[model samples]
Every structure is written in C-alpha cells, then in structure tokens.
Target chain A: MENLAIQLENVSKSFKYFQLKNVDLTLPTGQIMGFVGANGAGKSTTIRILMGLMQADSGVVKVLGHSQPENQTLVKKEVGFSSEEMKLYGAKNLAWHIDFIKSIYPQWNQAYANELLKRFDLNLEQKIKQFSKGQQIKAQLLLVLARKPKLLVLDEPTTGLDPVARHEVMAELALILRDEDRTVLFSSHNTADVEKISDQITFIDRGRILDSNDKESFFENWKKIQVELPSETLLFRHHRSIGIEQAGKLASVTTNAFTPEILTDMQKQNIKVLAVEKMSLEEIFIANVSYRRQGE
Target chain B: MNLRLNPSMIYKLTTKDFLLFRPFLVVYILICALAAGVMIAPIEGAYYLGVILVITVSIGSGIHFALTSVIIEKKENQMSFIMGLPINATDYAVSKTVGGMVVYFLNWLPMLVITLSLIYFSHLPNGLIPISILCFLQILTGVVVVLCIGVGTGSEGFTIVMVVIFNILFNLFLSVVGQLPGISEFIQGNEAVFNATFFSVFGIEILALILVLSLTLFIKSRNACFL
Candidate 1:
C-alpha cells in the first residue's frame, strides 16, 4: 500500500493570543484535501507547519513520508507550495522568475510553463510589481506548477482573485489532479471552491478541527430537517443533532449523522416532518463551527 | 536536525543577493574610485576626509545590503519565498550571514588595499598603517553588528533602532580609536610602528565581531520559524 501523502498526529502550536490544539489530519495519496476555515482559524498555521515553513510546538507532522522541519529540505524538493504570504521577486520580470525557479528545481517543465503563461494571460516581460493581484497569483502558481512536484500544498491560493481568475485557477488545479499519483491539499475560506474540487473536506475553526470527512459523506450526512412541532410541546432532540433553531411552531434542525432512525424519533414525538434538505458545504461548515464554539 | 548545510546552495543564494544588489555594488565601486582619485591627487585638506568617506561608503554599503536583503525581506513577507526553497533554517541563516559578510568584505577589501598602497608609496607616515588597520577592523565589526541585527530580529522597528545605535557606536568608536595612546602616538610619529595597545584594541574588535556573529546565528536558529 502507498503511504499517506500527509499526516499529522496531535499537532499543536501556541501564539500569544491563540492556541491550535490537537490538530489531527491525514490525507492519502491521489486525493485533494480542502482545509476549509475562516480567517485566523489556524488554516494558514497548519499549512505552514505542514509545508515545514514552521515547526509545531508539539506533536508529529509528516508530509510525503518525511518528518517536518527536519527532513524539510528533502520534503520540499518534491512538494510544491504556493502561499499568499510568499511573493514573487518584484524587481524581476515573470520570465526572470521562471528562469530562477527553473534553475533551482530540476523537474521544471518549460512547455507547461509556456502554456500556463498563455492560459493565465500573463506577460512574461512584465515586472512582478506591476502585475495586478490576480496576475501575480497566477505567476506564482505557474512557478510551482511547472516543477511537477509529487505533492502541492497551496494556502489561500484563490483568496484575492476575481471570479474569472478564480475559475481559471481552479480549472487548472483540477487538471493537475488528472495525474493519478499527485495529491493536493489547499486551504481556503471560500467554501464554494473547496466544495467544488475537494475529495476530502476538513473544517477548522477557533484553532480546532470541527469535522473532517469525505466530501460526499459530509454532504450526504448533514441534512437540514424542517419540522412542524405540535402545539407548544418541545420535540425530543436527537443525539446526532448539532444545532436546532425554533421559530413559532416550526423547527429547523441540523444533524451531522442523518439516518432513518432520526425521522423515526421525530415521529414518536408527534413532530411532523415537513421537508429534509441537504446542507451546503457553507452551511455545514458554519453549523459545525458555531456548535463547537458554544462548548459542544 | 538532520539537515546539513550545502555549500553550493549557499553560493547560489549568495549569488542571488549579489545580482539583486548589483546597482549598490556599482555605486560602491564609484565611491571607491572617487576616493582613489582624491588620494592620488594628494589634495591637502581632502586627504583625511577622503579616507573617512571611503570607509563610510564601504560600511554603508554593508548596512544597506543587510537592511534590504534581511530586514526588508521580513517586512515585505519575502522570507516565505526563500524558506519555501529546499533549505532549512540553518541553511537560510548561514547563507545570509556568509553572503552579507562576503559582499561586505569584497567591498572593504579593495578600499583596504588601496589605502595600504597609498601608505606604502606616498609620503604619509607608515606609523598610520597599524592604526589605520585597527580602524578598518572596527569598520568590519560595525558591519557584522548590523548584519547580526538584521538576521536576528524580525521587528522592523527594532532593526531601525539597532541601525541607529550602530551609527552612534561607529562614531564613538572612531573617536575612541583616534584617542588611543599607541594610535595617537603613531599619528604624530614618522615611521611604521606597532605597540601592545594597538594589538589589544585590534584583538578586542576581532573578538567582538566573532561573538556578535555567533550570537546572531544562535538567535536565528532559536527563532527560525518562518511566518
């Protein structure tokens, strides 16, 4: 069996005001793991530690079967990282940067770089400082993408892009996944993008991972059940229900473990089920975070 | 902990700095040329002032290199790009320290050689040679201190404060070195000479440079986490 592309066991880090606690994550090869989190939700910190840019204060972190901040140099050779905090050289033009990165990485693909330059509508002669934010991001992505690394760890890669640029970047990333051996792990606050492309979805908030599961199961299990309560009697809350909001005699309950037994439980309580709708990734993420934050 | 520093990686990293600061290098060369012209012309009052200018330019070039490559890189969030390469903290810290020192030495070396030539060929007292060498070592000490500040601290404000402190210490050192007994006596004498005091002060400066560079590396390794 092939080893996991990324793994973290009980990883934790502490800043002055925030603490990332017991962050456990694992992603096997050939899967894109979308690390979904709000701003300052430890996504960037996790990604940085995973990339070996920073060391975790506690716990083990292994990327591509090598330990972090120790085997970082070896791990880095095969792992391509593109982060918002990292910028292209401003004084150098895109072509110069391409050449610079090409010189450092032996696996650089000139043909693919040229294709990305055309697809991203980036001018090779333009200085990086002069490019629009979207253009700069695309240029940075091109540098990493051309290396043809075994794993790609992108942190907030689509944060500042326009809709069209985001779409193009996402499309390119999806195309990269066509290779059966390559794995991707990208962190994003934009749930739509994560939901669209990720095979595994991990939600993090307040420096804690609230939920991590396969995308299909995450969608399938989180059902927003709408019910009409009889009279003023409160219905029996199912064990799996994470959140319940009541308005007059109507109730909307969010559950992580949607099952036939949940409907049966409601039926025994004389609560008439009106409709059960699938929760969007955004909704599931929000409910999960809010529930966890309330000390659940 | 398993990572070992690669000399080739350090060279490549240093080359990147040299290429990026080529303009500054050119400016340094021109300033040295101007200093050389003044020395050759043997202008009466300009001779001593020209020496000061050349030394100042050499030291200033080092400070600028450190500020631009280290402090500014941190301020502008460019360290991420460097650390993203296939190098760990030791590689990064050592490369920057060695790179900055190499450039500083390269800039200071030519000036040192030119000044020595002037002392050897011209009518200037060779006694000034020993004293002048001690002063040049102080200049190297200053550059190393500035490099330490840049690499050891990520705070831009702290770096600025330290640089200001560097300038003040540099001026204080110049006056102190000028007032030392052997150096003072040498300035008033006619022949090249060396005394125990000259060696002591030179030795102290050399030792301080080594200590500060070590401390900088230690600090760098302690706070190696790239944001």
Candidate 2:
C-alpha cells in the first residue's frame, strides 16, 4: 500500500450526460500508467477526482498514501498535476511562476529547473501569453517537473504539440522517471506516446475502464491475425475475435482473448493463416472500444 | 481527520492576489487622492464633486477588482491553476475575500478619513460625520457582496448583474437612511448625536458583510468542481 502512488477503489461520479462507475486503479511508485480514453470519455473527470479538484460521488481516492481531497493539501504537496484545462497566468513570466510554485513546495530544485529551461528552450523572462502552444505546454511541464514531486498526474499533456515538440516532451518525461521513487499517471488518446513510455496502461471509454494492464502484457494479450480464405464464402470463425477487417480473400481478425487455440480453430476451418501480428496500443484501444460499444 | 488551516498558505495566497491586483490598487489610490483633494478644496460645489468622486472610487474599484481579479480568474481558466496549487477551494475563497477587502479598504479608509476630516474642519454638522461613516459602511457592504458573489458563482455575468443591483440598492439605502428621524434630526441640529436608528443601520451593514463572507465560504467548501 505504501508503494502505490495512486489508488482508486469503486470510485464513481455522475453528471447530467456522463458517468464514471466503479473505477478501480492502482499505480505503484516507479511506474508510469497511461490513461487512454476518447473525447469526453471521463478521463479528465477521473483525473480531477484524484486531484481533489472534484469529489467522487462514491468510493475512495488515495494519492501518495493519503485519502484524496480529505488530505488533498498533503497529497498535493507531493503530487504535481498538469492538464490542458489548467492554464498558466498569462500576465506573468516563467520566472514568476517558478517563484510562486517554489514558495509553495519545499522540494523545488532550482538546478533542475534551470536545466529544463535550457532543454525546453523556454525563456523565463517572457510572459506565458507570448509563448506558442507547444512552448506553453513545455513551460507547464517544466514547472511541474522542477518541483521533484513524488507523483505526477498529467492529462493530455501532448494533445496539440507538433511531432518534434511531442518527442521533446516524451523524452523529458522519460528522463523524469529515472528516479525509482517517482511515478506518473498521464491520460491521453495519443497512444503512441503512451505506448512509448508507460509501464502500465488503462483504457477508458464512455465512463468505464475497459482494461488495465502492464504495457508488455497488454500488448502481448492483443493479437491481429490475417487469414486467407479458401473461397471467400466464410473466413475464419472464432469466439475470441472482437473485430474483423476483411479485404477480398484476406481477413484480418483482432482479438483481446488470444490463445494457442485460435490457430487450431483457424486450421480446422481450412483457413490459411497469412500472418499473426501484434497490435499497437492504438489498434488495441480502438478494437477494445469498438468491442465494448458493440456489447452495449 | 481534523481540518487544519495553514496560515502561511493563506498569507501567500492573499499576497499573490494583492500583487496581481496591484495596478488596479494604484489606480484606486490615485482616484482616492483626487477625491480627497476635491473634498478639502474651497471651490463652489466641491463637496458634491468630492462625494461623487468618493462613491465612484468605492463602487468603481469594487466592480473593477471583482471583474478583473475575481471574475477574470474564471474567464481565463486561472482557477484551475490556483486550485492546482497545494490549496483547496476554502483557502482560495478566503484569500480572494480577504485580499480584495484589504485592498478595497486600503483605498477606502484613507478616503473616508480625509473626507470626514474635511467635513469636521468645515462648517458641516458634526452629525454628518456619523452619517458619512454609515455611508462608508454601506459602500463596504456593497463591495463585500460583490466579492462574495464573484467568488461563490465564479461567473462574470452573474456577478456583474449583482454589482449593478448592489449599486442601485446602495443609492436607495442612502436615500432611506438619509430620511431616518434620528439622522434627519442630527442634520437639522448642529450637534453630534448617537441614535438607535443610526446604530441599527450600522448593525445591518455589519451583519450583511458577515453574512456575505460566510456564504462565500459555505459555497466554496461544498464546491465539487473547481474547473
């Protein structure tokens, strides 16, 4: 319990149009958990609940070993949160923000902040309003990173960045996780970044978490099988398949519940397996969301 | 768990707002100074000009601070930034209310003192001094209401409507208080008089101020969503 940076149990919240139901999550220290969800899929809502910016209608949220919102002040002293909805004071310069945050957090590191300034190429003297979107995002990240927090929760941190800027941000995140005691839980629909860095990943759609697992096991569990049909009348029939993209005689089947039996089942159908490929994080997320929506 | 208030955090938050509203504070102070000069001047009808200027400074600064520092924080999405800090909504509400009132009075007190001094030194009835003090309380009450509304609603349009109503109602209050028997008697007579009616008016203003602050805190503490 002490090793976990964040823990959510049976947490629920409902709005007029959406609801997050019984979201149970646990991210231990020294790991990054990527929260993937579509637009308005309750990703930000869940993050807000954890930060104590919003209260859950039911259940518990614990961050940094303290009950959230109840101990939010204590929790916040150790957790650094950044989200797209959170804006920097436009009238103030980076220097002012640094000073302001430094005054609040005792763990602030001037040396690391300076290093980030050089790395991100952010001018501390320039007002935040003068920064470009990517620069602003980088500046926000720099401020949070320099705090040397025990836990970092970022919501869509790379949503609007160009590819280069995205790379820079991802690289900086990787650098932060070098400290074995630090943990991060970031939400993004951009699975590429999530795939590259997250040790654990959670998929949310509408208002529920569809799946949560370690990156390697999560990837290993999803398989994309391409099979060639004998006559095109029927491709391959398997109970485990969640999605199928067919093009003429070649049928691609995606499955979340992959096993050795799938190959035997395809062989029994006289279907020639063309290739068995691993699904990317994005592919798995799409297939997973598609499967859940279909079930609903 | 016991709820604890961090005084240092509150002070820092208050100081942050003070710095943020520094430019507006400077403008209000200058206006106040000009109003003070007008009150002491010997020009014809200078008293009326001074009163009008004082009212303008009082209400205008209230509206300006409530809009710029209070409402604009929500409009610009800076509430999330502030709430993202190591403070809760309670702390934020307390800071805004305290900081705004402090800055408001920084300009208001001096103007009140100077204007009352001018009245005292001049041929105006001593009773007008108490009336003037009551009027200042009315202005404080209005400003407090505006701040409370701004913090509680976090809506510019709603707070603006309330401020408009406060200004109109303040004028009505002044008219009604002016016509009170005790006040009218003091104005007609040249002596300073402590009257029940005048104290009742003062009590209402104090009560309103307290109620607004308490309501702001109540609304803020129950807020489930900051952004």
DockQ of 2: 0.61
Structure candidate 1, residue pairs in collision: none
Every candidate's chain B TM-score: 0.88, 0.90
lDDT of 2 by residue, A147-247 (tens): 98888999999887889888888887777665455689989989998987798999999999899999999777799998998876755446788888888
Local accuracy of candidate 1 as per-residue lDDT tens digits, A237-256:
67899888888789999999
Model 2 chain B worst lDDT window (10 residues): B1-10
Consecutive 10-residue window with the lowest summed lDDT within model 2 chain A:
A230-239
Q: Tell how far residue B155 is off in model 1, in angstroms.
A: 2.7
Winner by DockQ: 2
Best-matching candidate per lDDT: 2
Q: How does chain A of candidate 1 score by TM-score against the true chain A?
A: 0.95
* Cα shift from native, residue A92, model 1 (Å): 1.5
